[model samples]
Target: MAAVAVNSPPGHADPPPEGRKRPPGRRRIIPWAVLALWIAVLAAAVPLAGQLEDAQRDESVSYLPDSADSTRVVRLQEALPGGEATELLIVFSRDGGLTDADRRAAAERVAAIAGAHDPAGGAPRGVPSEDGGTELYPLTLTGLDEEEQAAAVEDVRALAAEGLPEGLTAQVGGPGALQYDQEEVFGSVDATLMLATVAVVAILLILTYRSPVLWLLPLLSVGVATVCAQAVVYALVQAFDLTVTTMAASVMTVLIFGAGTDYALLLVARYREELRRHPHPLDAMLRALRGCGPALLASSGTVAAGLICLLAADDNSASGLGPVGAVGILCSLLVMTTLLPALLVMCGRRVFWPLIPAHGSEPRAGRGWFGRMGASVSRRPVAILAGGVVLLGALSLGALALPGQLKSEDSFRDTPESVQAMERLTDAFPERNAQPILVMARDAAVPEVVAAAESTAGVADAEPARSGGGWTEIAVHATDPPESEGEEAAIEALRDRLAAVPGADAAVGGPTAQQMDLGETSRNDRMLVIPLVLGVVLLILIALLRGALAPAILLAAVVASWGAALGLAGLVFGPVLGLEGLDPSVPLLTFVFGVALGVDYGIFLMHRMREEALGGLPTRQAALTALRTTGGVIASAGLVLAATFTVLMTLPVVTLTEIGFVVAVGVLLDTFLVRTYIVTAASWLLGRRVWWPGPLSRRPEPAETSPAPAAGDGR
Candidate 1:
């Protein structure tokens, strides 16, 4: 192979011998100063970052809409006589029938729990199943905070299971037990996600860079970004009382690594190219930063803006994710743009090690894979474009198989004790409600509200449970099992009937109602937030690209990619993974990330294409040149980002797993298929029209000339 001079981009020219000297004293001082400043910042940030876990609020109330009826019910319930009670149901069941000894053991265990905890309700009475196969005991432990409630639930479970008969099993269920189980999942989420994400990102980086030292720089910068972002988020929570859930923190962790590393890859690639053009490391790095800096800023801004649109969501978790994610993106941008560049300059060219880019050494030429792909795509642009669109559309048909909102009991990958207990209760008490519907009304109209609730068509029982301040709480049980269609109808009927009571001001809520409210709010949020996210991203692309047609084309490709990702998820989530349904937040969150992140690769490819076009290349040659130059880095970036999200699939929570799966699929599609084939093909076919309304659209192609060697020829 013969080495040839790599083509300089656009107007760039080789530096004169004197101009290729070491950086001046001031220029050298800048990177050192920047490094010192970061060290000081990290010193202060470490302690604050450690406090982030303590600042997180994972309670169900933390995720509910601020003004929803369910949210109000929770607030009022906390004001009752005993603060907020931890309610649990104890179930003792046998496959065939409970013997007299089994019944005695169940009662004795319930009595022990009552004596130990001093439950608010006097003593729990056993409710036997008609088949004599199971018995249930309901109890409430009041005046307990979240920690105390978790402790109480565990204590009750231990007491209830003491010395159970061989054939009989005892399990705890209800709002309190369910909450404790959910808390357990979230308790380890941060550690689990961080470790998995770090491992995944490290492996991908090692593969992408193929240099141990080079991979460490990006990883280190991302780690710095994570700590700084967490510290910032913790401060926000302390000051503004932001709602930070386990989900938000976990997603933010992924974003910092995924998006931050993306910036590093683009900058590094450009730096490698500049190194071949300049003699000094600092000069090469400065040139690299100058070349790709705007694209980096624009791409990061687009992601941040899309995430910021989440502030308009009604669901607390969704809304909280907006700022938390935005903070993470900004922090990542700051670190990559500042700390990473300084580190690379300080480390000098040897960081690339075995494959260092020597000054004036031209790269060898070979038949590159991306170049071949571009050539193939260019040869049949229309056919390729139509085929890609049809293929994505075909994949999107899986959306029809998507199930409804996932039930709380089914939200975990493995059934916890609470869900197991609920399943047993459902089997044993087919006609009885395992959970009560809570109704709150003005104290003055408590009697009338109770009367209306009791007389409702599906009401099995309704009684005033507690009163405090100006409100009274009533417990209503339906005639059907929890979460069943019959039970849902009964709840609606009770609400309707209670609403008709003059001056009652009644609000209906409970475990089932909370799930209902989440689903409805999520549906409404999609309508508002999706459009908002798309608009924000579109505007950013338009501003960055300075073309209506190009931005529209990029947006459309990302949107189609999102649909294809969701459709694929729908197919896998149920038939392959055995999941019952999706979490209400899954679709909207995936769409936000899918579109925002997917567009990044398009930006990389198109920005390069635009550069080539501006440098006097014909449209067809410009498109192919851009693809040949940027394909490797974009593919590497897409893989890194996809793999980081894939780490979430290793988590036990079903919602996180679904989110990871969908986003990973979307990124892979965008990297290999959409950006590589569809976008490039469209550019080749549309020619300069892809940049309509921009100056490039009106400019004539330069006369045919000898093609310069491709930049980073062998990269």
Candidate 2:
């Protein structure tokens, strides 16, 4: 009896060659099915995205500060925008200060307009401004729903236009106008970003691949990702009644394309290298996956970790972004690894058909100058470190001056209805805060509260409430938007007035206060999320490398990258973007996104370095091997990633624009500097210590070979 080994395939030393060539069973079939499921979801999602309410509060800011009437006012402010009420900015310009006759005429005209509603005739509401010169009327739409608010404002605008008194002009601005302005900014930026994104992506891909056919692969994958991701987001919102801003679509565009292209580049770069290595295309693909798969997984895992970290954000914002972004990127990476591979198999030679070169005699590690550069850099570790530091130092100086002010208008920029209304408001009146400040008191203290509030500093005079008892309502007017810090002076002054009111407490409650709270919340959210994301990434790096020191060092690099990114963004926006200040929200967003995601490169490089080390190469030799083999992939992936994020600069909203630039710059720096120079240098200089306390690393043989390169070449 022949002693045949049980595991060997029918007494052969190895499994079938085709087994080695073709992709395994489960990996090939599942992705298309998943993709189909996504297509179905998207078919259900687009119409839904258009239906939800805007994320910003058209409602009043609620404060538990002082008065009982404050509660009543809070109820009114919140209820008003829901069709229980609306407000119009009434302006009157006279040769002199408003006198009794002018005041009466303005009041009467505003009241008449307020009384004139739809055929239902549930009179529009009216309230005078702090100054007699202008008044704001609060009108409830009687029976309109949230979707009808835009039309309601338009109707009111038309009514106001026709009923102006002699020598007096009236304009409507509030939640209604804000809704319109938001839509304008979103539409303008979105269109601009769309055109710019397409142009930039096309040109960059053309430059990178120099093939139109290759260019379309990423576009298809990304398009599918966008439709599916949006559908999921819509379903989530509808099922859970989730609150998302109109900016979701724009954000989805940036994330899907950016992640998709980056992943696509990784695949193409691998495929090209494989084609150069083998006589057969199928053989080349297997070689590509074995060489490139793990590293791609490492890069994407870190990115997923970064995005998932958004769950650490204080409100639903970070959490919402976490799911949307993480799910989107996962979708992108899935397409990259599986769908793309299958598609490549189907397309075969045509994927890069026009420019296929003859296969070489053998596939060799370290493809020439790129390999040499990696080898040389690992030798002069200190110089590399010095250069990296210097580069980061220069770029980071820009971040210190970053403006922290977040524009309130950012959330509403997507809807047509919202934009038209905002435009009407801004054109008609540029300075409206839209959300009104209210002084509320308990039901029992309503009368005294109204009297006291009427006497407050910012209060010009007040209206006697026709409605709630103990809820004698009084309206106060702002000298400017209550949310403006410029208005802080008047608010403080008003606080003093409220300070003197007997048996009543008054605290500022409106958009300005909400803005203040939001700023504080964002800052606090940063303090929390950075650590959480960093920790998760650090643990992941540790698990990937099974090393102690690699995680710590990579995490340190990420922190440095974050600081450097913020420092750079500060320079661009604090001055160049002419922002009032760094959207206080920018730093937190950057830290969780740009910094955390940038960790991916470090993870990818380090994962390969560890693999090479385990394969018995010395620290320097492993570093050289990792760099030579992985550098091109890292650079290619980084280019697509950076390019994708960079497209945000073309968006109209300052937030997206600033974010795009900073994050793009960070990815570029990470690929070129951090992965290539710093990681390699550190690994070389530290020698065995870079992977310290886990296992002692060895220094393997470094061959100085001649410079005749292999087949396919595209940097």
Candidate 3:
């Protein structure tokens, strides 16, 4: 019989003869069909994605825990007369102490602001600071939404700047002004974050593939995923009233680009390998997807599951992130798995260019770097394990130095005018509260609430501000500085005092109260959400590996990585970065991202190891093979993921910068140290027991012989 030619790569198994062939016309049609379908989807998603910025809710009510008193007060404020009041403090300061000219200029500006934007309760009045160096005009601008409030604040600022006396500085500050500044920052976040993320991803992809053409495919696919995820989130916000914060939206972009690119890298790597085995690109893609599909699905699934556990959190911002982040991951997975493959197939093998994986070609045969590392690890698995543990433990010690909750004044990387104004107020008025505490009580009990607030310890003064809608608003000034321990204690004392008012049902809220609530709720959320995330990720790992031991090991490694990452962040943020303290949300956010992504690399390595083991290699041999075959891909993916997050460091928001730095560091740690050395060493040490309780764990070690040829060898 005449020999049948088999166009297989030198090192890999021959392509299955049956079902390898497809009609050429169908192959052409399918890719075009997928491309056309995605184009349509992208078209429909554009408008909705644009609406995502509009749907963002960054108000305190959006992020505060529902159980918090501040949250209740915020809700009640909306029901007050003319809706929630916008308070602005127009601060005018001079270092040499304000002269008559400065005071007159400040008063004139205040009067002009009142004339332009009709103050709600009364005309603006200047309150001189004790040292006479600063003057503040407390104005209430009511009956305006966010846009109008921002415009009003801007007008006030403009008036203050016009005809200002020499050596005098003026700025608008208060909760209203701070909110406006934050809105301004968030308004530009989408464009800025997207640009930075895309630039980073494009650069990383170019380096990883070393092919200009290959990088564009993954980038385009991720862009589509981002748009799709945003559209879905927009619909959820509109239909289900999902709370989408600016932070959440920004984070979703990062997740989609980072995680989606990760999936693309894995898929492309597998496809490139298969290209050397199959004659047709379509056959190669099919075989590649078939080989890597489950691992990809499980990787995204684990991420989604772990994120969804955030739903159990009390903080609305944290809870909202759960669905938003998961949606992004799922969208990325869908596009990468379906659309990316079609595009790669359509482009054909030439897309790989100089390093194209031609059929019948073999990978270089030698013990690669990962192979040598694995060999070294296998020889002294216990020492490597102990060393890894010690290193991680040492890094974790930095957590003890982490600063306390981040204050609002410290939230921005670059000081905004509002924050500077607050600082000026703090410095000039040490005895008076610049930002007053707001107390809401039933109108009938207003007198009682006021008296109690006045008599409360730590309260400098209490006065009725407004009365309507069966509710009365009282402004209480604290004797302590804003967000200080004394102020926090005073707030608690005020709440306790008000709680004792018979039939009053009072609530305390303001910047101070909000900060206190955020700190407490964050602590509570960490307590509740951490276990839930761990459990969810653990369950997914067990299901994917179909055993308890490997999943447990993976979980332990990731948790250790998270602790070390946070500890390192603690050490760096305050001393090196000049941050005042770590944001309360950083720990929880980093834990979720680090653990989920760390486990992602774990899944990649272990799944490959399991595949080798099932192919009848002993645990040590399987570990070495998995490391040699998968190490480069994991490293590339980790670098890409870490680089995408590093883009956040460019943002001015301290929270995002902190999150970006911590997660990036964590990913690099997991990629280089934990996944490469520790996990591989553990696998070698545990041997078949790593897959304990599974049938494969009991399978006898393959008979000893000359080691299997290195990964690229065409044995």
Candidate 4:
């Protein structure tokens, strides 16, 4: 009989005994069949995935809360004459105050634009600033679709640039310009995010596996998952009219690579271990799946569940992210489990290259860094626990410094042309709201609505801009700057007074109104989605761990880490990075990701500990054993996940950058500090009680003979 492998070195797979191989039958055919099935599926999915960009709905109404006044206004406006008009403000300015030449030149440029484009109203006239240094031309370009509107804006900008007199700078600003910039950014997002994410994942995989050939398997599987996810999302959008935002699409990629690679890491590590015991690669893979499959399913399910809770959000953007993100995670889980295993089996033992797990060999025991750390932690459990708490608490204090909701102008890392134009408008029109307040009223109540708006305290002017489909559009200018406290108060007052008009179902909307709605909806979403995510995650943990105490401990540690991460972000975002304020959605996003992903490491640790305890080791010994054996893989997974999120920092959008930084930081903290020290110490201190209410929580029967092997022994 051939000797069975006890513990093999890393990456060296043992060959089967001579004349001892089992008959080759359906097993060999099965792997190639699975691989062929995936190849066919990938081919069919590529075309559908290519169409995903066409399904994106990035308009303001697409993101607004359904119950918000801005949303109502948008719906009503679409029913009006020529649909919603694209409004633009053209500003021509000179530093030393406008000369007669600059004024004449500005008028000529305005007339030139009027001639080239069909204006909704008559020819636009230049309205000079109070200081006489700037002239503004308000143009309403109506009766055009999205593409035509973009073309009109581009043409206007071109004319302004070409016709501007020397020393008089001109820019196109307003709703239309901002919308164009947003579209431009989103249009390129898929390519930029995909490329960066792929690069990051590939680098991490190469480093983690340290094999020229092994890293490609997971990356290829993840690629298949990504395309499949996109195809699914595309179908959802086409069939159900789902809203897909740039933020949601970008985040989907991050989740796929981060969560998918994490599962791959756990599976690969288990497969490597199994290789030492089972001579045939196929047998080893089966054993690996049996061991790690449940953990991967639970972890992915937890993340998907937490993300699905976003459907409760009032904001369309937030709600859309729920299903979109869930699909990505589920697809990744599907591909990684099925396709990855098949590929690994077919590739054979040599896929591991330099560090193959040869059968009948034992790994050196009790000498790894994780084992030493575990021993030290077991000796000073109380001290480690207290220190971890203090460290997390200290980091969390930074949350107090986090800035308020970010403004539109500060949305990007680098200022785009639209932002620059808006700034110029701000400087020239400090007393007047460059962006008009849009009010939709019943057509019958137009006179009353116009009168009330003009009589309002903060009203600079009110005019009936358009009327159709039983709705009258009133353009009102506030006396205060856009998004200022005074402007917000005015908007509220307008809504209040307009609501009182008989037969008028009026709704107030504009740039400022949208901001108000966004802020309110974000706050409401946090209240709703945060609890839902927590409940979902807690339930998943309980199911996976099959006990109460261990799940609770894991939950507590993860929640603390999330808070600490946010606090840390607050410090860096505002004080250090000099950002204006955080995006309102950042807190909720960070919470969901930090808790869901952070808990993953906890699951990896506690699951292994439970396994050790079940195998008859004492509670303290089990905890230490689990940590020593699983620590390296957990650390590697953490780094890979963190690196993927950090890729988001390369984007110009401030929101993505913030999400990336906070999530990446949170994952690292959980892996190194929370999982390595706090969880380990807490488990050691609790002993068997960590699995309370389960059979393992009770004392086991005494061993008949010799003491159990050292915690780090491969056995």
TM-score of every candidate: 0.96, 0.78, 0.97, 0.94
What C-alpha lDDT does candidate 2 achieve relative to the native structure? 0.59
1-715 in candidate 1: lDDT tens per residue?
Answer: 1111123455366455464455489668978999999999999999999999988888889888777787888988998888877889999999889999999999899989988899876778999999999899988888898778988988988888888878789999998999999989988788989988888898888887788799999999999999999999999999999999999999999999999998888888878877878777777777777778877888889889999999999999999999999999999999998999899999988999878888887665654778889879977999999999999999999999987778888889989999999888888877778789989999999988888887887778888877888888788988888877787888788878888988988899998888888888999999999999989898888887779999999999999999999999889999998889789899899999999999988887778788878777887788888888788788888899999999989899999999999999999999999999999999988888988889899999876564455544433
lDDT of 4 at 416: 76
- In model 2, which regions exceed 4 Å deviation? 1-84, 92-144, 159-171, 187-195, 276-287, 357-380, 394-397, 407-435, 451-474, 478-481, 489-508, 696-715
Stretches of model 3 off by over 4 angstroms after superposition: 1-11, 17-20, 712-715
Q: Please give the clash total of every predicted structure, in order.
A: 0, 42, 0, 18
| Candidate 2 local lDDT, 1-715, one digit each (tens) | 0110012121112223664544556445554565565567557756654443343222322112112233334555444323234443444434334566665665665556566654223443433434444444455444454456557666666666564556665555554455445454654655566566666677777776766687776777666666566666667766775545434456556777776777677667656655654655556555566655765676667777877777666544445666667667776777666556656655666677555434543233325555766756756778878888777777778765665566454442233333333333333333443345545444555566556656655554444333343333334555454455655554556656666666654444444554554566676777888788778877877777777787787777766776777777777664565565555556767776676678777766776677666655566666666666666656766787777788776655666776777788777777777777777777778777887666553343445334334222333
Candidate 3 versus the native: TM-score?
0.97
- Which candidate do you rate higher for TM-score, 1 or 3? 3
CA lDDT of each candidate?
0.86, 0.59, 0.86, 0.84
3 or 4, which is superior by TM-score? 3
Worst 10 residues of 4 by lDDT: 1-10
Q: 591-700, model 3: which lDDT tens digit per residue? A: 99999888999998888888777766777887877887788778889999999889888898999999999999999999999999999999988889999888878888
